[model samples]
Target: MQLKGIHHVSSLTADARRNVDFYTNVLGMRLVKKTVNQDDTSVYHLFYGDERGNPGTEVTFFEIPMAASNKRGTNSITKVSLRVPGDSALEYWKQRFEEHSVQHGDIQKQAGRLVLPFEDPEGHRMQFVSDEHDQGVEPGTPWEHSNASPANGATGLGPVRLTVKTAEPTAAVLKDIMGFSEIQSYPHPNDTDLPDIRVFETGKGGSGAEIHIETRSDLPAERQGRGAVHHVAFRVEDADELQQWIERIKNARLPNSGFVERYYFQSLYFREPNGILFELATDGPGFEGDEPFEHLGESLALPPFLEPSRSEIEARLKPID
Candidate 1:
């Protein structure tokens, strides 16, 4: 079965409250899920997305209060892209970022699309990509009640950029193992002197369903901490497809966490040859499974297994709002 598109990207943050404020109040994404990191119950795992926290729209964070600042380098998810309505929306966001004092670069064209690059308070690299001419997987609806107008609000995730020491091995895993098709290449936005960045896409490809790989022999392996992306997940249709993918990955002889029950979705985690973590996750049983849509993120939520220890988990997490 073909993968749909990006499921979500999970990153690190040191301060949960400030992180929530920036994503919800400034960026205007809805805090769709307020929960604890399943692997580490002591910390908060917050999810932000368009109105309903659709699969491809989510950007998540794990709170690590004492984590060091991320040291930028190769072998990392260097930048995350969020899709806005159109080129005009870029102008809207450029003005909004100014009003909110968000650090951003002037709108520029990258890989044939107009984009406005910006960073969150924690220095997480992100850009707002215009979907004026985008096709393929549909975008999610922006939250109506957020600070930004729904017309110009960020819709869903776009192409995720992976910076690696060398491109061949990582590209091989994407093309040969993961079924991504190499579509085209473009000059690296920051350095035209380096090798051109390669673009890859899967099912119903477009801005929403592509991966941009940047090969930089110049930088060292990344020192991941706060603001570093932990992993990027691609979307599979359902549990059955995920199970089939688990078998496929096993056949490919990659070491992986097979058949993980994430509650909201099933997942299989593995790393590409360059050591960048990749996850294949199902698209159903989403954020609304536990809480009513209107009240989502208003209270801390736990999966069925974690429900027994909710009291202890709640005691450990600092209030994010």
Candidate 2:
């Protein structure tokens, strides 16, 4: 069974509205789903993605006010990289970030591509990689709230960088279990402490097909909080393939959430040996499952089981915008 590519990267946010503004306005992604986190129901679970909120295109957040800042160290997702169409798009984003007063770094070459590094308002690490190698999504409907038009807008997610104390364990999970191939190694772009980063390729060996593992033997364990990535999900083809993975995970004796239904998609979650949480998610019954395509993210939506407590849940959450 092939783990397709990145389904979504979920993180924690301090303020839902601020997170929404940055992702929708500054980053030029569509707010595809607005719902409360099922586990808590007191906070918002916001989803941002491409025009249709396609599986690999999504980035979600759990609103957690008063949460501590992320402690960057080993066993954490250090950066979430989004794919932009080309060099022009990358330049447009660089200018857009500058005019908007968004903190960013110099556009530099990394892994044979141009990368523009930046952070969200809550300090969640983000980057835009120009996929000249044709590794990004093609332009479709334009993002309505921003000037980053379809031509230069973010296509979808690219590689996610995971920091770990040792690469072997995480490497094995990515390679053997997740259907990724150990591609190559590169010097850790920003960390002088890391000797080199291991790279893996899943689908086409570019953009969403990649995963970068940064080895830091000297770093401390990560403490998750706001701006920290809680988990990264990889997409599975459909229910049949998802079931296959459930069996594989169980047979391998890997600790995993046994085929949990997430409403939007069914998922199987497991932590890699180093502690980074990974999820295998199905692609169907997506963001449109509970809402129509046109009215997505317009109001709060709850999963079937939680509908009974909708009133109480709604009472607890502050309006996002």
Candidate 3:
């Protein structure tokens, strides 16, 4: 069984409303789902994605006030890169970030593609990669209320970068279990002295299909905090395929979450030897399962099992604008 591409990248957020404002108003993604973390019903799980909440377009967050103050380091997802229409789109984003006073770096060439590095208010690293090769053709639908114009909106997610003490073990897991190919290598874009980063790809291999591993042998392990990524999920076809992955991981003696029904999708989680959390998720039974496409994220949603406690959960949660 092969993975399609990244399903979503889930990170930590301290404030639900601020997170909503930044992604929806600033970056121009739609709020696709308003739900709670299934495992811990106390925290809110917010999903941001393209118009229909497509798999590759999602970047979600778990709002946990207590764990909101963590640090970044090795053994973590250092950057969540998004694919924009072209160089002109990158220029548009550059102007937007400047106007909004968001922390960002000047446009530079990374792997022969234009990239603009930036961070969210909570310090989670993010970047926009230009689709210079015309690899991504998915038309991004800008949220009607967003500040960004529809013409220059972000298309979808691009190469995701993960930092680790070494890339061998993680690379092996990617190639063997995740159906990724060792594509090529490039010098660390930020630091010339560090080891060259190894790139991998899944599915048909373009744009959102890539994963870059930075072998930062010198840096210590990362600390989990507000800006830290909780896990990176890959897209599988459906529940049957997800079950196949569970069996594969079991046969390989890899530790994994057997089967988790998150209402929107079924998920199975596991960690590589280097400690980066990886999830195998199905693409069907999407965000529209509970709420209509036009009304998504407009109100809180609780899974069937949790519906009984909806009142209590609603009373406890702080309203997000």
For each of the candidates, give the backbone clash count. Answer: 0, 0, 2
Model 3 alpha-carbon miss at residue 263, Å: 1.0
Compared with the true structure, what per-residue lDDT tens digits does model 2 show for residues 1-321?
Answer: 777778899999988989988988788788989998877889999998888788778899999999998888899999999888787788888898999999899899887888999999888999998878764333234455544577787777888999888889889988887789987887778775658877787764568867898888888999998899999998888988898998988887788889888899998999889989999888888888788888888898899999999899988888877
Report lDDT (CA) for all predictions: 0.93, 0.85, 0.86
Taking all chains together, the TM-score of candidate 2 against the true structure is 0.95
Rate residue 131 of model 2 by lDDT: 74
lDDT for residue 227 in candidate 3, whole number 0-100: 90
Q: TM-score for every candidate vs. truth?
A: 0.99, 0.95, 0.96
Q: Candidate 1 lDDT, tens digit per residue, 209-308?
A: 9999999898999999999999999999999889899999899888899899989989999988899999999998998889999998999999999999
The predictions' CA RMSDs to the true structure, in order, are: 0.7, 1.7, 1.4
Provide the global lDDT of candidate 2 against the true structure: 0.85
lDDT of 3 by residue, 107-213 (tens): 99887789999999999899999887845324345556656776677667888999999789999999987779997898887788989999899886776878899
Candidate 1 vs candidate 3: the lDDT winner is 1
Off by over 4 Å in 3: 136-140
Error of 2 at 24 (Å): 1.0
